[model samples]
Target: MKIAASLIATLALAATTIAAPDNKHGNKPNKPIVINKKVLQTSKVPFIPHSGTALFTNWVGLNVDFKYVKPVFDLVNATKAYGNGTLISRGEAHITTIPPTEYDNILHPAGVTIEELNALAAKNNRLQRARFGLECLGRVQVVTKDGVFQQSVQIILKNYKDILSYRNDVFKLFVKKGGNPALFAADNFTPHITIGFKNRDIFIEDGVYKGKNACIHPIVAK
Candidate 1:
């Protein structure tokens, strides 16, 4: 009886060991790796508040495919408090090709409307079926209409040669059509998608609020 009991116990132990979940085989989903790092402000241009109507009346950009950014959205959701910002909707995510600052110089002065620009972009051979890769995360500060500064988190993009080329082509076309080139000349175009914005003023350089408050660090997920 003792021998039989010992064999049965051994069999039960083996069964339990075999049934145990193994993380190495990916039986469980891997948790996102979150890192807190000090990142410099990449752009000198002020962040435009899309919620406001007066400043951002019209802008040109290429819509980003959600599949390539879903993981980023997931990461945003996972680390919302760390970012302390509002999440941008999936449908609204895009890479800004031509900012509103150039509207007066390129679009309006050139007699090219937003609808017309869209049509042109649709027919462009290079832009057709083109996609950009996500490079990294960046943060910037935007001066609001009230002169208050707020922090914004953005996703920097890579593999944007086609987009850059298209932008230059548009600029040249506008300039040729008697549009003012002053604003375009001074404009520093950085192709990125703003993912979220924090309401409170956060110093982007040191990631602190007004240099006295605690720092709300930007979360990087991998």
Candidate 2:
């Protein structure tokens, strides 16, 4: 009778052990169940151009007189930056009026139509009469993150406040029209013309060049 009772108790214990939840695979140990409430953004974001040929965006600025800067380019070709017998001769030089950044995602938000922007662009065309000047200071070189030296020009522009005001007003309207507000540079905008992307050793003696009325147009993205 004692053997029988012992076997019955052992079977009961085994049954209880098997029936209990397995903590490793099924139930967590006294932990509250967590559910993620945040939704992941799945929509594809827009592209913003930083450097190079403004490929995906539009640009507006004053057309440079290539004839005037030819000598400077000749000097640049002789520098260490372009010493590989490479010469830069045929890129448009212009003071950035409305940078490529201004047009990125300009029509993303609701209610802002391209027609409105085009109308504003028409008003801005009056800026075609705006005259400015640039004084090429000297060579500017910086060690890139890849440990290679990169160089470009250090230039100063006259009547920059007017440009800034125009940029600010356009940015405000863009935001009010539902464009992204974060893309605009409301302050701390430095106006500099990029002479070369890889060569910084080229130097042009300090000189002031006056500009005629430049075109101010709306940049359309590709």
Candidate 3:
């Protein structure tokens, strides 16, 4: 009877050890990775307070083309059958900084109409295009809970600091035009090019494709 009790205790200890959470990747076992699927819902403009629901596009961002990095797209597309295909256009990768809700609050107070906002975005694009561009480093694979995965290309701005300066300068312009500078979040920005999103964590072959190109267009209300 003593031997039997010892075996039970040993088994319980082993089971508890096995059930302990693993922190190999620094992610907590129960914490979820929330992938932004906002782009998928393009038809309806997401709701914003104190703004008229005029069917206006919710966000404006910098559109970087993949002309120099077409091979990366080819690889992602070839492996897309496993789960997800490319959602972004072959022509441009959207760089979201000023999200719509905040943008509305920034502009509406200043009486900046949609047409005027577009014009400002276009002007900012032109000013930046004359100075710097973006570079593609390679592929970055992200594996989430339940084995869901996503592939994206790492993008680096050639003059990131300079571009940031430009963003600040443009924010000043908007503020002068009646928008709020306090609404901008400069700390939470990251630069990357998303290739595709997957439903399941299926292993897709990862590879590197290298190139650099000038980013000319900044699409607003698009």
Candidate 4:
């Protein structure tokens, strides 16, 4: 009798797992409670791109030429922040725009989609599933073009990955211990960078997102 009960419980667990999203690989109905991985994220998110690629998220033409760029650069140069006289600030961050051929009309740039994400999981032999939520301003205004927009750029922060900060808001929402990417089951803190020419999505005063994303200033060289 006990053996029969154990078998029944196992079958029930297997059924539940099979109902979840199917993995990319061709696996026979996976067993239940199959998700056993964590999400990875980090704190101190990286900065935005330099002037060269900053236009990736902006529309065709917009007005976003920041005049203070030179002065700020001067201040950094005048300071002894660079002991070796090397300009490392430029290497801090970058935002490269994918060609339209990748993902044409999507609101945001080409990132790992649900399909690709699933495939990655299979390739890495991941069965447990989790999600992280983050966003990038879809468009921005260009100072030069007057009324152009830039494409949105957002990265999908997933589970079983390493995170910089284990205590972000999204991680708190789903993860318990903290935002440490190493212990993530599912997280939502998406470290993102957006390029906008004249986007109002950013909060100039408060210095945060007017809606769902944070403000990113791309300090590029002329």
TM-score of each candidate? Answer: 0.55, 0.48, 0.44, 0.18
Which residue segments of model 3 deviate by more than 4 Å? 1-58, 76-91, 124-154, 177-180, 186-188, 199-222
Q: Considering TM-score, which of the candidate structures 2 and 4 is the better prediction for this target? A: 2
Whole-model lDDT for model 2 versus the true structure? 0.40
On a 0 to 1 TM-score scale, where does candidate 4 land against the true structure? 0.18
After superposing candidate 1, which stretches have Cα over 4 Å from the reference? Answer: 1-55, 67-71, 84-91, 124-128, 142-149, 200-222
Best by TM-score: 1
Model 4 ranges with Cα > 4 A deviation: 1-160, 168-186, 202-222
- Once fitted onto the true fold, the runs of candidate 2 whose alpha carbons sit more than 4 angstroms away are 1-55, 76-90, 105-124, 179-183, 199-222
lDDT for each candidate structure:
0.49, 0.40, 0.41, 0.26
Error of 3 at 2 (Å): 39
The alpha-carbon lDDT assigned to residue 104 of candidate 2 equals 40
Residue 192 shift from truth in candidate 1, angstroms: 0.8
Candidate 2 residue pairs in backbone clash: 151-200
lDDT by residue for model 3 (1-222), tens: 998777666654553443232335332213221223332222222221222455335554555444433444444344332113453334544444344554566655566565554454456353224233344333334432223334444333444454455456556766777665676644334444544333321122221121232121121111
Q: Candidate 4 residues 1-222, lDDT tens each? A: 998777666654553343232235332222221111211121212222212234333211111112222333333333331111322233122221222221122312323232332233233222212223332122111111222222222221223232222223223432332323443323322333232212332222211222243222222222
The weakest ten consecutive residues by lDDT in model 2 span 35-44
Candidate 2 per-residue lDDT over residues 43-152, each given as its tens digit: 11111222333443454444444444444444444544322334344454445555444444443243444344444434635333344444332334334333344444
Please give the distance, in angstroms, between residue 173's alpha carbon in candidate 2 and its true position after superposition: 1.5
What is the overall TM-score of model 2 with all chains considered together?
0.48
